[model samples]
Target: MTTLVYLETHDGELTNGGLGLLSKAASLGGGDVAGVVLGSGVRDAAASAGAFGASTVYVVEDEALAAPLPQPRVDALEAVVKESGAENVFLPASVLAADVAAGLAARLDAGLNWDLTDLRLEDGELVGLRPALGDTVLVDVGWTSTPRLALVRSGTFDPVESGGTAEVKEVAASFQEFSTQARLVDHLQEESSGPSIEDADVIVAGGRGLGGPDGFSICEELAAALGGAVAATRAVVDAGWYPYAAQVGQTGKTVSPRLYIALGISGAIQHKVGMQGSGTIVAVNKDPNAPIFDFADLGVVGDLTQIAPKLTELLRARK
Candidate 1:
């Protein structure tokens, strides 16, 4: 079998999630694993995929792909899939990736398995593990047709370097008329200090219990002191107390930090699925029966307003 891993890039660098997926495809080991990079000025980023375990890197550099759009990418990916004769295609979940995967599936009339958390080879066939029934259980999923497409959940795998190199093959870019019609007008980057939640080793998340937007000051201070990042639950984001980019839950981003501190969070199943992969979980809530306490490694039944300030003070003092 031949597997094609889509290596998504941003600002001329490969995304950790995409690289991690590439490493996973290589580890499966039953067949040759290749990576396909689609973007303008992405040759350097494509070359780096070899270190993460892509034996072959297909590059399609075109001005049409300069902006992170799905349709043009779908066109490029389809061309590469046909050229490579790949039986399987894998992509990490992202706004652009999700769109591209859906478009590719529709264009190729192939089967797609999405929101997958894990994948393994069984009897020389690929099987994906998808969370079902509110993420309480994992169900096995597979495609009955060839060129199986899968979109995995973010942060499900970590990139491992193999100190190898890939054979770079450039492919000509071609796009359907409808795909090239949409054009990017302006791009604005979010201004943030410190590590992003996805890359942070520690994350301090706030929820509805924080009272309001200002209540996140304690979380910010604690995250700053711990050299981490600040996150928020879906409820907090929906209330406009925090930016949607910082939200963590079923509708938000998935993260697997080394340490996760939940303040005022009630630990709804929607929120738990996003951060359950953290190495160490700690919760501080006044309610003793809060669901977060059930899974937290260290649960403190107390008021977060008081506890969080003291914890931040202690952490800063240690520095």
Candidate 2:
């Protein structure tokens, strides 16, 4: 089987999620593992895919695809898939990638299994594992048609370098008038310091027990001390206490940081499903009976207002 992993780059670099997926796709070891990069000036970034396990890197560089729009990418990806005859297509979940994946599925009349957390080859067939029933259970999913498409959840895997090189191949793409009809008007990025939640190695997350919008300062200070990023629960984002981009839960971004510290979080199932994959989970809450304690590797029954500052100060002093 020939597998194609869509490599998405941002700010002239391949996204960690996309590289991680490419690494995982290479590990399956059943077929030729190739990565397709679609964007203007993405050739340089595509070269790094070889180190992450791509045996071949397909580059589709077009000026019209400069912006982070989805339709042009769909067109480019379709051309690459057709030319390469890729039987399995994998993409890391992102706002634009999700749109392009859906568009490609419709264009090719293929089956798409999205929100997949894991995938494996069994009996020479690909199987996708996804959360079902509100993420309460894991169910196996597969495509009945050729060119099986799968969208992997963000932070589901980490990139590992294989010290290999890829043969770079350039491909041409044709865009439909309708696909190029929409033009990007403007792009506004969220101004943030430190790592983004999805890419952060350490994340200090806040929840409703934080009391008010201003309470995020506590998480910010601690996260800063640890050289990490601040995250929030759906409750805090819904209450306008934090930006929706920083929310981590069932409806929000999934993060698998090396260390996840929760402040005043109740550990609801919705929140658990997102960050449960963290390497180490630490919860700080005043209530001993809080559900967060059940799964936290280290549980501290204390007031975050009192503990957070002290922890930050101690970390600063040690630094």
Candidate 3:
């Protein structure tokens, strides 16, 4: 089987999620693993995929793809898929990627399995693992047709450098007239000081137990002291206590950081499904029987208003 990974680039650099998926495809060890980069002036980023284990990198650099639109990307990817004869296509879930994946699937008449958390080869067939029943169970999923498509959750895998080189192949850019009709007017980047929650090694998340929007100050202080990013629960975001981008839950983004600290979180099943992949989980809440304590590596029953400030001070002092 030949696998093609869609390498998404941001700010002229390949995203970690895309590189991680490329690394995983290489580790699967079933066939030739290649990557497709679609954008203007992305040759350097395309070549960099070699470090993550892509043996072949397909480049479709065109002025039409200068904007982060889905249709042009779908066109570029379709050309590469036909030229490369890739039987399987993998994409890391993102706003643009999700749209491109759906468009490509429809164009190719292929089966797409979305929200997959894990994948493995069993008896020479690929199997995808999907969470069901509010993430309480994992079910196996597969495609019945050729040229299978899959969209995996973010932060599901870590990229490993293989110390290898890739053969860069350039593909001709051809787009449908309708694909280029849309024009990008304005692009705004979110202003943030620290790493995003998806890329942060450590995350400190706040919840409704914080009592109000002002209570997130403790979370911010602690997160800053630890050199981590601040996150929030759906309840806090829905209540207008936090930004929706910082929310973590079933309807939000999934993250797998090295350390996850929950402050005043009740650990609903919706929230647990988002960060269950963290390496170490620590929960601090006033309720001794809070659901967060059930799976936390360390549980502290205390008032976050009092304990968080002390913890932040201790962490700053140690630094």
Candidate 4:
């Protein structure tokens, strides 16, 4: 049996969300774990799979994968499906991954489970757990079939060691069809100024209560003082208060930074599913009963609007 996790990139760099999904795949994956790599650095991305618990890394290098389009990933992942006797397939819960997982399922004559919050092996069968109705309730996976496809919400899981020497295998995966209709538009890569949130030792994340885009500056000030990166919850991302790149939650990125600071977030289950794994958690929210406080190691009930500037000033004075 094969347990495969499809990976994506952020700013052309490998995404930690994919790595975290692979970590979950390692546990549910009964046999060989295949990490399907697509895009520019297909060959070089093998090391990262090992770190996330994939022993066999399958690489498919093609320019089409440069963008996170469903067709390319669908084409590439199908190639892996054909070659490996994989009974299960996993992908991260991003716009691209979700599209591809569903499309791949249709193409492979299989079934798919999207945004799974939990996974387990039951009576020798793969089990999937996910939230329905905006996470107010969880539903057991309804689909069960050969090569079961699961879309894992980012930040909901921890991966184990893929458990051996990394095996690099290159395959012939193509997304040629898409190239015909799609124009080769020019693309520009953004250079991250400091340690990316994924790479940061500490992260200060703000939510809706920060008020708006302006609120992040307070987080920026604190993050800068602590030499960390600034992140945001989905509410902030959905509110357009911050760039989609900086969002952290079920639908956003996954980070295992040393410290994760949440300001004004109420800690929705979907949001908590993502960052609960951080080593240290500190929350600043006005509502004392906010769910974020439940998972937070340290919780302070206060207004972020009032406290953020003060915190920033305090940090400035420290330096």
Candidate 5:
């Protein structure tokens, strides 16, 4: 089975999530794993794909594809799929990649399995593991036909560099008139301190138990002491206690940090499903019987208002 992993780049750097998916696909050892990159001036990022395990990298670089839009990428990816004759197409879940994957599925009339957390070769067939019943059960999903499309959940896999090289081939652009109609007007970036949750090794997340918007300062202080980032649950984001960009839950971004510090979080299923992949989970709550205590590697029964500041001070003193 020939696999094609969509490699998405931002600011000339390959996104870690896409690279992780590419690495996972290559690990299957089923057949040749190729990568498809589409963006203007992205030639430099193709080599990084090889380091993650792509045997070949197909690039479609053009001025029209420079913007982070979906239509142009969909057109470019469809062309590569046909040229490479890829039986399986995989993409890391992103706001833009999701649209591109959906467009490709419609263009090729292929089955699309989305929100997959894992994939494996079972009995010579590709099986995708997806969460069902509100993430209570893991269901095995498969495509009935060739040219299967899958959108893997973010932070599902870690990219392992093998120091390998890839054969880079530039594919010709085949853009339709309508595909290039939409153009990016302006991009507004959210201002935040410290590392982003996606890249942070440690994340300190707060929930409704934080009391109010001011309570986030406790999380921020702890995150700063740890040289990490601050995250929040959907409840706080919807309540305007935190920015949506920092929200961590089923409706928000998935993060797999080395250490996850949850303060005042009840560990509802929606929030647990997102951070369950963390290496070590530590929860600080006043309730000893909080649901988070059931899964957290370390549970501290206390009021975060008193505990968080002290923890931050201890970390600072150690430094």
Candidate 6:
């Protein structure tokens, strides 16, 4: 049985969350732990993937692979999937991964599982766990067909060192024109680089209940105090109160932090779907009826305007 994980990377750094998926997929089967990496940073990316248990790394290089649209990488991945005879495909529950997974599943005629909270192999059959109907219920997914595919949520599993060297092979191809409708007219990357939100030690998230843009100041204060990053809910981002990059929900980044502190967020399933797996979760909301309280390990009921500033001050004093 062979399972392949699409390794995610940016610039020259491999994604922190992708390593965890490699570790999880490796535990499920005993075939080649292959990785599909496309970009100029393939060598470093493949080396790091090896520490996470990858045995084979296929490098597909092309400028168009990073040519604004990711359809080329999806095509490259599909070609590799067919040639490698991969039985399973795993990817991080990220925007790019989600897009690539959708395309790959459609191209391969395989089932695509999204944002899996739990995964296991029972008697050579694969199954996944995820929230259903807006976090109101849990669903168990079983693939009845060949070459199973899943997008595992970040932070659900730990990445461990499993000493192995990945054999790097090159695939030459010009991937574009497949999805020609979407053109790459704009290109931008993050100016500041540090820890990714999903890999942070702490995350302080703000929401619309924060009242206004000023509400994020307190979140920043707390995050700075804790050496973490600031996150925001979909409501805040949709309303233009926060940047899209800061959004932490179904439409934003999927994060798994050591400690996630949510301020003024109502526990919408879309928001929780991406961030329910923190090591410790704390929430502050004015309404005790807020759904976020249900999954939070610690809850504080109060207006963030009054509560957040005080907490930030107290934390700073202690530090």
- Candidate 4 contains a number of clashing pairs equal to 3
lDDT of 4 at 10: 59
| lDDT tens per residue, model 1, 1-319 | 8999998887789999999999999999979999999999999889999999899999999999999989999999999999999999999999999999999999999999999999999999999999989888989999999899999998889999999999999999689999999989898899999999999999999999899999999999999999999999998898999999998977788999999999999999989999999999999999999999999999999999999999999987888
Model 6 agreement with the true structure over 8-105: per-residue lDDT tens digits? 77767677677888888888765678877877646666666777788888778766666535687677888788777988898887767788889888
Who wins the TM-score comparison?
A: 1
Candidate with better lDDT, 4 vs 6: 6
Candidate 4, 261-317: lDDT as tens digits: 888889998777667779999999999889888789999999887877788788789
lDDT of each: 0.94, 0.93, 0.93, 0.79, 0.93, 0.80
Stretches of candidate 6 off by over 4 Å are 174-183, 190-194
TM-scores for candidates 1 onward, in order: 0.98, 0.97, 0.96, 0.82, 0.97, 0.87
Q: Candidate 5: list runs displaced more than 4 Å.
A: none
Clashes of each: 0, 0, 0, 3, 0, 1
| Model 1: residue 170 alpha-carbon error in angstroms | 0.3
Higher-lDDT candidate among 2 and 4?
A: 2
Worst 10-residue lDDT window for candidate 4 reads 175-184
* Candidate 2 all-Cα RMSD: 1.1
Give the root-mean-square deviation of each candidate in angstroms: 0.9, 1.1, 1.3, 3.2, 1.2, 2.7
Query: Which candidate gets the maximum lDDT versus the true structure?
Result: 1
lDDT of 3 at 135: 82
Where is model 2 more than 4 Å wrong at Cα?
none
In angstroms, the error of model 3 at 252 is 2.4
